[model samples]
Target: MTSSAPAPVAWAILGFCAVALVLRLLWLSGQVRSSERLVTYGLLLGTASGLLRERAVQDGLADLGMLSVGLTRQLSTVVMVLTFAPLCLLAISWSERWPARQAGISGLVWASAYASGIAMLVVGTHARSLELYIDRAEGWQTPVYFAFFSGWCGATGVLMTYTSIKELRAGDLRPIHRLTYLTILVVGAWALEEALSIFVSSVCAATGTGGGFVEFRFRANENNYIYLLAGGAMVAASGVVSELARRLRIDPASRAVRQLTPMWEDLIAACPEIPRPANPDIRMSSRRRVHRMTVEIRDALLVLGRYAEPVPDDMGGHGGEAVQIVRALRRKQSGAMPGQYLRLQASAPGRDVLDEARALSKITKHWNDARKCPEAIPSLDGDRAG
Candidate 1:
């Protein structure tokens, strides 16, 4: 008697499904309003369907238990059909350009395929199960059952893949475009598995025996399990990529374009003669770097302003004292500027960075000079003017 291969892969698949569930729960509990949350739900539902189907099918096979193979098959078929609804909803909700007309058409197609497939599977399986289980034991061959599963998965796969690719190409969620591409690729793998299963079952029936076709049967099953594992992990991974991109604040497209698009329009309205250049390449990275440097310098000045007393001049040279102050402040400032500016730059840092550093240094000098001259200390209004 030939037996099925070891189930180590199935167990591993279950482990990932469990991890995915835990991650979803953690994300939902967090305070951030994240689109990742929606993707997480779709992923959990997809993987849970696989897990339960496998468990139900295995239990039926092992013990001829309360759940028959026919019922398990029907349950799995229904679950696979329902899986697309959440995924479709996720794609539609996240999409900025999924227009009402496009969405309505897509919805009708998905609903029809799913409804017809489930309906046929239910009716056919019930007919075969009247006297006995409608699975292999009943010698029942309902092409409609397989056709429904095939059609539902095929339609969903095409719709989601097209929608995801279009959304990315249209530059929605530009920073997370790679994740979107990965999602479609992963879903394509699932479509391939479903197609393979349908093909294998049909070939087995035509051949009138499982001989010479057992390998395809095994491959088809393995692909299903692999598809679930890879697809679930990819969805969760895409969610993580999106969150990480947001945290890093990296815009994949032209950040300057995104920023100055509205600002420039307003500027043109205010000043008509301001000629807009044709193909201007405004690199925002330098501007961002300078803005960050300014923040660091301000923070350093605040730290240095807290010092009660200065080190004695004899203890170190004037330059050494300056370096000490810069060092003491660097910890708070997170090394925004050079500890020894003369060493770091042949000329000086960039104009913006140097200017901010100089401004901070001047403020510190004024505060120290004022502390030394108590007579010069002014009232609140004078202080405010200063």
Candidate 2:
């Protein structure tokens, strides 16, 4: 007698593929950065593999339309292997910061599993004569096909599990940890399902005659679809929760906005010459005496005589204090002595002089350097002479 397993299995796989597609699309919609394109690639690979596997099993052939079904089975196996390799690398990379070595190890693990699976598929296809021997209960050789496929999935599942737990323990918050955990659980479930699938298929392959316990007609595809739907929902839900957590930690302000707001007010107070954007100065006064005094003080530094002690007074009062502190620091001395920089009680006026003093001190350093190293100074006369 025949069985009804194959039809429902086919439909279930198709339905799971549709839902996986939806979840992936939703994920891609939220991410816009070019650096995040890996996520898109992974989602595409996984979805394509599942769809291809479903097509191969249900259609009983591949798109290439080879008369032999063995080639299609091998192709499906390859797709499954290729789909998870990048994901495993991503998981390892995410776990450790800037971990090229860890990612390489993850790749190696994936490669080993992929190789083993392909090798078994080759062996099973070529040695079709084993089916009869296996039916006669020919020991461990009977279960070699099942064992190979199960081992391949189990290895990946273990790596994903380790990575998830490692990251979670290391305080990776919100979306990253949650995403990893969901991936781990999905991989574990897939591994289990693969084992079950192999067991059932192996039984069918081994027992050439019908009526052995585990029949090929036993359908698990519907149940597998339900599992995938649940897994995908969990993963997407975790991502949403992570996004919320990120928002809580860091607000929505752009980096420039965050940097400028605190410092702008202070700068405006320190440098009154910096005209307010709203009010360009409309009036000009015959205050040449005031401007003349300002220019004289600025030019005074340019003419400080040689072989004189770099006068501390020329460096503004705060400048003098900064020089003293630097000397003390250089000597490895630590104790508060004279004037120290402090943000003070009065916001508008108390620290205004200090800002001015600091500016003059900086200019004073330029003059001091020139006095000590005249050769370092560029001369207009020298360029003309050249």
lDDT per residue, candidate 2, 117-147, as tens digits?
5775565554344333222333344367556
Candidate 1 local lDDT, 354-379, one digit each (tens): 44444333333333333344322222
Instruction: Determine which window of 10 residues in candidate 1 has minimal summed lDDT.
Output: 377-386
Report lDDT (CA) for all predictions: 0.49, 0.43
Every model's TM-score: 0.48, 0.44
Cα RMSD (Å) per model? 14.2, 17.7
Model 2 segments beyond 4 Å from truth?
1-41, 55-64, 102-114, 126-142, 169-218, 221-386
Where does candidate 1 stray beyond 4 Å? 1-5, 29-38, 53-57, 60-65, 97-121, 124-141, 164-176, 182-186, 189-193, 196-219, 237-386
Clashing pairs in 2: none
Global fold similarity of model 1 (TM-score): 0.48
Candidate 1 displacement at residue 164 in angstroms? 4.6
Total clashes in model 2, counting residue pairs 3 or more apart in sequence or in different chains: 0
Clashing pairs in 1: none
